[model samples]
Target chain A: MATNTEITSRDSSAAERRGAGTAERRGNAGEPPIRPPVDIREDGEGITLCADMPGVSKDRLNLRVDGNTLVIEGTARLELAENEEALYADVRSSVYQRTFALSGELETGKIEATLKDGVLTVRIPKRLELRPRKIEVQAS
Target chain B: MFSIASSASDSLFDELWQLQQQVDELFGSWTSSSGGIRSLPRGSFPAVNIGHTPERVDVYLFAPGLDPKTLDISIQQNLLTVTGTREIPTEEQATYYRQERFSGEFRRVIALPEDIDPDRVHAKYRDGVVQIGVERREAARPRQIEIH
Candidate 1:
């Protein structure tokens, strides 16, 4: 029942709200307005993306580009102090999750993601057969 | 003489104390090492965020690259359990490369407060995130006192 424009507008508003607040206040439960900023630039035959996912370790993160949807899910387990009580009076955990729907031009199998200092950068190159090529005119 | 109201309050407190003791006894007798994994089979417990508002309790779970049909959720007593497994990616054409993704059985259990109405719980899954809203029972909701 929802139109695409309506959904996009809502997403934009949520993004704005996330941008307006402190990083901690950006996201809560049940909604995902806050996400690590990512820049996807087109290279000669591929795309390079850099995402800031602080506190996420290589063991806790997963990246999969299935079809046209790129799924990113991970856990950021905060170290509990030894002296602190087991029960939490405030937030119990921190989460870092994001999902992006990529365009058809993306080559899923060629994508590569690397985590460095909590930042995730993914490079996806187009298939050699998929890239556009200019044809030379046949000599008369 | 002690008022009847005071006696009733004392009885209620006693009941609550007994319930707490019973919960503690059951959980304590279990052989579960707290740090040991409680996952179902072949999946990992993704990150989750839980929030409590006055009227409702909200829970969000992050799990992608999973089939919704494979995911199972159940509420027994005050415990909410989510369990499922994801298929491992297998490719015959690609050369040797690094693989870093979880695929297996996973289970996550959350204890709900006594105030939550089990019958009023509603859940929805979208965009690989599961959201559950548990509404408080009517009797547990706060009402303004009327001035005589």
Candidate 2:
């Protein structure tokens, strides 16, 4: 949900990419979720978001947007044969999740998402009225 | 008197520096000269997980947004190295609000515990993760000997 603070700060550069949510819900499947690194950019049209999610496939990836809340979730599968024994381990969790309370100015219905090379790209265009427009100046 | 006091402080500082290094090592994974920077105290590109079996070692490296043709994996004795380059997609006239993904050449060299057969190494890249399986040295086998 968009709060007054979140709505007013939507124009700020920090809020633009903070498409990374402040209210985080983690710890599922026995381990804490890995907060996948994300990048956000804004143009005259809307916001473009890219999240790095290695080991995630198209089938395992799930992205949802609801009432200004954007959620990204995926599971990373690591194969270990029956005979293989673990010597060293680092990736403790297979789940990756992130939530973002989006600005009200965005057109959630027009969001486009694509997954490639284990990276997720989500494009949410701004509302037509909210987008920047050039104002023609009359002859002085 | 000042010169002698300064030398004493210098030695003390050296001892403190070594102690700090030891503490860092104890707290993190002593992977190499860089130590444990895998999203811990420090962050490293293409985070990796290594495991072993009776025959071979298994390695999984997580890195997204890379060209498959650029990946290179090499094994020399016990050292295994994976290197590649990730180029940022060109964005014209776009203003970035946040950039966190790593884009550039990345190299990870790990010294394994036992010698590995260089020819027995098998590596595959899929979905942005590289899986490396290396067979241990064939010469290492327990033998039974008769003793009087």
DockQ of each: 0.04, 0.37
- lDDT at residue A60 of model 2 (Cα atoms): 63
Q: Give candidate 1 misplaced runs (Cα > 4 Å).
A: A1-18, A21-123, A126-140, B1-44
Query: On residues A115-139, what C-alpha lDDT tens digit does candidate 2 reach at each position?
Result: 7777888888999998998999999
lDDT of 1 by residue, B20-88 (tens): 566434333221223224323222345455556567766666554456678888877667888888565
lDDT, candidate 2, B20-109, per-residue tens: 676435434433334433223235788877766667778888877787789988877777888899888758788998888988898888
Q: Highest DockQ, which number?
A: 2
Residue pairs in collision within model 1: B41-B105, B42-B104, B42-B105, B43-B104, B43-B105
Query: Candidate 2 at residue A37, lDDT?
Result: 89
Label model 1 with its docking quality class. Answer: incorrect
